[model samples]
Structure formats: structure tokens, C-alpha cells
Target: MMEAVKRFVGPKWRQYLAASLASYGSLCTGMSMGWTSPIFPQLRGPNSPLAEEPTLQQESWIGSLLVLGGLAGPIITVPLSRYIGRRWLVMGSNLPLLLGWLLAGVASDLPTLYVARLMWGCATGMQFATVPLYIGEIAEDHNRGALSSLFLLFINVGFLLAYAIGPFTSYWGLTACGGILSLFYVPFTWFIPETPFFLVYKDRNTEASDVLKKLRGTSKEAVQAELEGLQALVAREFKEEPKISDLWATRGNVKALGICVFLAMLLQLSGIDVLLFYMEELLVKVGTKISASDGTIIMGAVQVVTSCITPLVVDRLGRKLLMWTTSLGLTIFLGLIGVYALLDSYYNYDMGSWAFLPLLCLIIYMILFTLGVGPVPWILVAEMFPVKTKCLASGIASFMCWLAGFIWTRFFRDVAASYGIYTAFWVLAVCCGVGFVFSATLLPETKGKTFDEIQDMLNNRSKEPKPVAV
Candidate 1:
């Protein structure tokens, strides 16, 4: 059995294990995001535990607070990862998540619930900022996309778990499950090795070499050659640690930062966050005859299945192709949903028989979304920057993502109420259209490229640079 396990992990057991552990953190993030969907409906019901059921305004606060809390994660985790190492920092992130889940399980007041979600948001930020950096450093170039895309796949799994289980359990029971899920990440983290990049950065070359040997399952001679190449690449590429200002100062840095930030914003603007947060509410508002819980479950299932397809083909099809496809698909579906909402709202159209259309559109949107926008941003963020600038740049990009989520989610209900839900969908559709143009014009292909090669490609150095010998 041990031999079987070892054979399965192959030459890259360390990388695979590290990614698996970090992905569990993403799973917790998904659970936190998906929690609102099932719990919101329950809180509004007559049998609610609260003395007074939350008003719609309060509900928005409840949903948006997670993003608001998320804003702190990049600020804290990015720098902290520098000092403590990525492995421990990620392991430590689970503490806040577990506490948040436990608090949610027993909370009797709105304030308590708010605090719990805020902590979960902090964990979300940590995962987003740290995992990509870790995964980028550890994986082999050939399978990097397949490994990194696991981040989104696991997130969707967490979402599906919440949607499938939350409705059947008490609030306490659901949260207990989340807290239990957080615990699983700890044991996994123990066996996973730190990235050789970080070890080398810290002047621990021997340790870095050993880690490389373990990760590659290679002989010492091969590991030494691979390590030397990495050392040479790092020496040539970076002279000093990157600062926040560096994100804009250098031409290459600026281009990379801009792409990361824009992609992050586009992900939120695609309406996935809002959909996950208020899937039930949106279904009710759309007057869909499909039960909200059932619709939410189906959406979660579709997201998981579609997300699985990306890891299989991302390396084969290339990043640019998927981004273009997702952008076009999102634009069409979001626009269709807007038109449906417009007709329903203004034309006094009864959508009873055609009720399934909105749900179908959203499911299709989720499918397209998982294929690219959902996973590619993190992959690109990890790929584009020099190692020196990776953590800070990724943090900035992540912060922008959470900031966009905060703004969109906080006011989504108010916007829908004041301007009509159709207007909100229209705005998202416009964002998707812009995304299509951006993907076509600015996005670079990173398929099957080494980290240094990607940086060179981004800088317009060469399209066919000789492969870095390993």
C-alpha cells in the first residue's frame, strides 16, 4: 500500500502534496462562500433562531462582510509568508477559518455572525495570496496548469459539499462540518515540503537541493543540475527583493500587474461571487419554478464538473484559448440573462413556462466561468512575475479581487432593488464584453513554459527561447 502511494505520487510527490494541502485551504474558502446560500434562506424563514429575521439590507451586509474581511488577508499574509515560509503560513491560516466556523455554529446574534465571516474572509485572502506563489514555485513546467487548476476544482468541491449538505443540517451542524474540514488541512501540511525557490532565496542551497530531489524523485546529479539552472535564472532575473512600488515602476512589472489586476476584477464582475452568495435569492427574484435549493445544488454540481475539465485540457489547449472562450461564453450568457430580466421586469411577462431559461443561462455561465476566469487568473499571476516580485504582486492582485468582490456584493441587492435586477445583469454583461476584448488583445499564452520563460515571453524577449536545462 505504501509502495502504491509512493508510485502514484511519482517523481513529483512533494509538489503534488503541497498543492493538495494548499487546495484544501481553497476548499474552506469555497465552503465559506457557499455557506451564505443555504444559511440565508434558513435565517429568513419563520423558524429562524434570531429574535428578528434579518432585513434585506442586513442580509446584504451579512453576505458582503466576508469580502470586507477578505481585504485584510493579502495585507497580512503576503509579508508574513516572506518571514515564516509558505508552508507554515498556510497551515496557520486554518486557525482563523476553524474559529470562524465554530463561531458561526453557535452564534445567536448578528454581530457574532459578522465576526465569524470576517475571520473566514481573512483565511480566504491568505489562501489566494499564498497558494499560487507556492504552487508556481514547486510544480514542473509541463504539468503546472494541471496542478494549479486544482485550486479552483477543490474550491468548487467545497461549494458542492456545502450546497448538498447545508440544507439538510442545522446551522450548527453545517458549520461543524466546515470546522471539521479545516482540520484535515493540518495533517496534510505536515508531509508537504516547502518550495525549493523559497529555500534557495533564503540561502539554504543544500536544503533546497534536497527538496528538489524529493519533489522530482531524481538522482542527486540531475537535482543538482536543475537547482543550478534555477539559481542561474534567479541570479540573472532579480537583483533585490521587489517592493510594492516595483509593481508599477518597471515596464514588465507594470504589464504583469495590470493583467493580474484586470483579470481579478473581471472574475468578480462575471457575477460568480454574487451568484454563489445569493443563489437562492436570485432564483426567488427570477420567479423560477425550480426550487432554490435544487437549483443551487445543480449549479454547484455543474461548477464542479466543468471545473474538472480545465485541469485536463489547460496545458494542452493553452491559457489564451480558454480565456477567450470563457470571455465570449460569459458575454453571451450574461447578455441573454439581462435580456430575460429586462423583459420580465418591464414587459410584465409571465416567465412561468420559460422559467427554466434563467437557470439554464446561469448554469451555462458557471460552466464557462469555471473553464477559465475561475482558475486562470491565479495561474497567470503565478506565472508572469519574477520570483522576487511574486508575493507582493500576487498580494496586490488578490487585494484588488477582494475589493471588487466587496463593492459588487455589498451593493448588489441595492442595485437590483433600485435599478432593477436586469440593470445589474446588463452591467456584468458589459464587463464580460470588455473581458472578451482584453483576452483577445492582451492575454499571452503561457502553455508549457517555464517560469523564467514566461517572464521572458511577457517581456517580449523571445517566443522560442531555448528551454532551461534541468
Candidate 2:
């Protein structure tokens, strides 16, 4: 495994560095724009008179509009990657992001903030689609999983940083810090390269070879071998142009699509967003009278640490097995939290020992999710679809992901308000159970497979065992 990684990373260190930097750009946007959610209850809590602040409510509305704007990209991202290439899209999309950040930082009203967030979401979604597509295309088969997993790790880092800043800036102010952080995009565009696959897609074979050679710094023979592998993978995937109809017309792809949607939905409804959006309230209910501010920071810390464990082990455990184990474990933990909440409520919130249990259970649930569904699904999205199906499938799949995010964010507040925190957790536990069974039965292992070979595995064309690298 070390030899295989060296063969790719030896010559391709520059390309790897560029890709990693661009990935940071995407994640910084994700982390910064949404930092308020995790700590919203603290900054504008029900207990605080500032709860009436239009700013916090508007931020939620803006988040919805932002997701709506992102939904538009599926129409163009496929053809855009095919025509203009992924690198230029990455370069060009930053313009809107920059503008959005400027507008948001300066905004004083709901309307202005809404428009800013909408535009930011569109550009940010483009980055999300393009970054992984670009990274997966550039990485040599032997090292792609580890490299792609880095994107997930850095995203959590961004989340950790953003959450840290949210509370930090509350002491300082939002506008100043947000504006300063937004400028990171300028250097991102300056540094990253166009994906070699995009060049190949346009029939710029020589440029593609040059990019590949730069990224795969080994002997001439090894470089040639790497390019040949990529070319073969691309050739196999692109034999047919993917159509929207293919989603339903092909049974195997449809099954894979269904599984992706299920996983995406499960990720959201499993109360991950609730944990993010309402950590303070949940923590208070369960027994800790800790400030919402401190609770948000603790939640962020858990997320960052737990997410670190996934990248280290995901390539080794294989995707399906990881999902199976964690989904089941998460369900049990969530159920425990629900029981604790119910029991505590009956005791008039006086059972301090029982109250802390929900907080402890939630931490365990977050760790389990980070180890499996959090990063693995994104990696699967990058690897599962063929070139033909990749655009629409990814678009639809991503839409499902954000849609689920939207639902959880919008409804969890109301649910916690009406049903009580205990019942809310029970609902999440049910979803986790569904996710575990679906994963164990329907999701296949895609570890150690080439991008094209994964498409083949999805289609069931090659059944002979593909070797799993430890």
C-alpha cells in the first residue's frame, strides 16, 4: 500500500497540494456560512430577549433560499463540467461567492440577506460538485480513496474553525469576522489546477497527459500506466451519454440511486442537524445548565474529533461495513437518549444524573455517524456513478441531501417545541434503524475499486472478488 501511494504521490505532490487547497475553499464556505446554526440557540436563545432578533430568523430563511439556489446547479453542472471543464467552473464560481459574502457581510435587512445567501448557495454548490469530481479524476486509482477522504477531513476542520469563530465573533461581531474569512477564496482560485479528466473530455489529450504526468510523478512507464488506467476508466464510463431517464430506466443504477437517496435522507433525519442546530436546548433539557454558548462549542469539538476517525479507517473498513456498524450503533445510542429524556421529563427535570445521559448519548451518536455516514456517503457519491450517470445522479442525490438538511433544520425547531425533546429523539432513532437495515442489505462495498471498476461493480458486470487493500 505504501509503494502504491508513493508511485502516485511521488510525482504528483503539486497536483495533490493544489487539489487540497481548492477543497479547503469549498469547506471554508460550508463551515463559515452555516456556523450560526450550531450556536444559534445560544446567541439568540429562547431565554435571551435577543430571541426576537430578526437577524437569526432571517438567517434561517436565508439558509432555505440558499439551498434552493443550490438546486439550480444540477441543470448546468453536468454539461458545464463536460464543456467548460471543472477547473474553470471552480475558478469562475468564486465570483458569485465573493459577491454573496460581500452582500451578506454588509446586509441590514431580511431581503438583502436572503438574496446574498441564495447566490452564495448556488456558487457553493457548484464548488461542492466540482471539487470531488476534479479530485476523483486526478487521483491515481491506488491513492484516490485516501486523497478523496482528505476532503471530508478538511470539511470537518472548517466546521470546527467556523464554530469556534461563531462564538468568538459573538464577542467581537459577525460582520467583521465573516468578511475577513470570506477573503480566503481569492487565494484558492489562484492556486488550483484544471482537472486532467476535464482536459481529456475535451479531447486535449496532450494537456491531459501533461497534467497526469505532473500529478503522477513516477517513472515514465508508471506515468503511462496511470494515464492508461484513467483513459480506460473514462472510456468505459462514457460509452453512453447519461440521460435523466436513465435513473428509472436502468434497474441496477436505479437501485443504487435509491440506496443513495435513502442514505442521504437517513443522514439528515437521524437528528444530526438537530444536534447541530439545537445542541444548547437539548443539552439544557437533559440536565446540563451549561450556557448554550459552551454547549455549541462542545458539540463542535465532538464533531471534529469524531470526523477525524473516519478518514483514518474508512479506506480500511470498507464503506458498507462501516455504515452497517455505525448506523446500528447510532440507533441504539439515540434510543438511549430518548429514554433518558422521557424519564427525566417525568421526574420534573430534577434527575441531574439522568439529565446528563442524553448529552452523553448524543455525543456517542455523533461519533458513530462521523465514523460512517458523514464522510462515506460523499466518497460514495464521488465514486459510484458512471460518467454518463454522474451529473444527473449526483445532482439528484445532492438535492436529496440538501433537501433532507432543509427539512430537518426547518422542522426540528417546531418538533422539539411541540413533541418534546424525548419524542423527537425517538423519531430519529427510528430513522437510524431504517438506515442500518438498508445499508446492511442494499449497499455494496466499493473499496479498492478503480472509478470505472466501481461502475462495473454497481452494474454487476464483474463478480469476481476485487482485492481489498488494508
Highest TM-score scorer: 1
| Decoy 1 TM-score against native | 0.91
Report how far off residue 301 is in candidate 1 (Å). 1.3
Model 2 lDDT at residue 121 = 67
Best by lDDT: 1
**lDDT of each residue in 167-267, candidate 1, tens digit only:** 89877778888888888888877777888887876778999998888788787788887799878866865676667787776677788889989999899
True-vs-predicted CA distance for residue 380, candidate 2, Å: 3.3
* Model 1: residues with Cα > 4 Å off, grouped in runs: 1-11, 444-470
TM-score of each: 0.91, 0.85
RMSD of each: 3.8, 5.2
- Which digits, one per residue and each the tens of the lDDT, describe model 2 over residues 1-470? 64674576675676567667667666656564455454454435443323255553454564466666665555557667777877777676666676776776665555776777677767767776777777777776666766676666666666666566666555225445545665776676676667777676666767777776667665556567656666786787777766689777765677678777778777877777556645555777655555656666666688767655666688789999999899999889888877777777755656664545666677778788888877777767666765667677777777787677777666655665687777777888888898889889888888887866766767778667889999
Candidate 1 least-lDDT 10 residues: 233-242
Please give the distance, in angstroms, between residue 329's alpha carbon in candidate 1 and its true position after superposition: 1.6
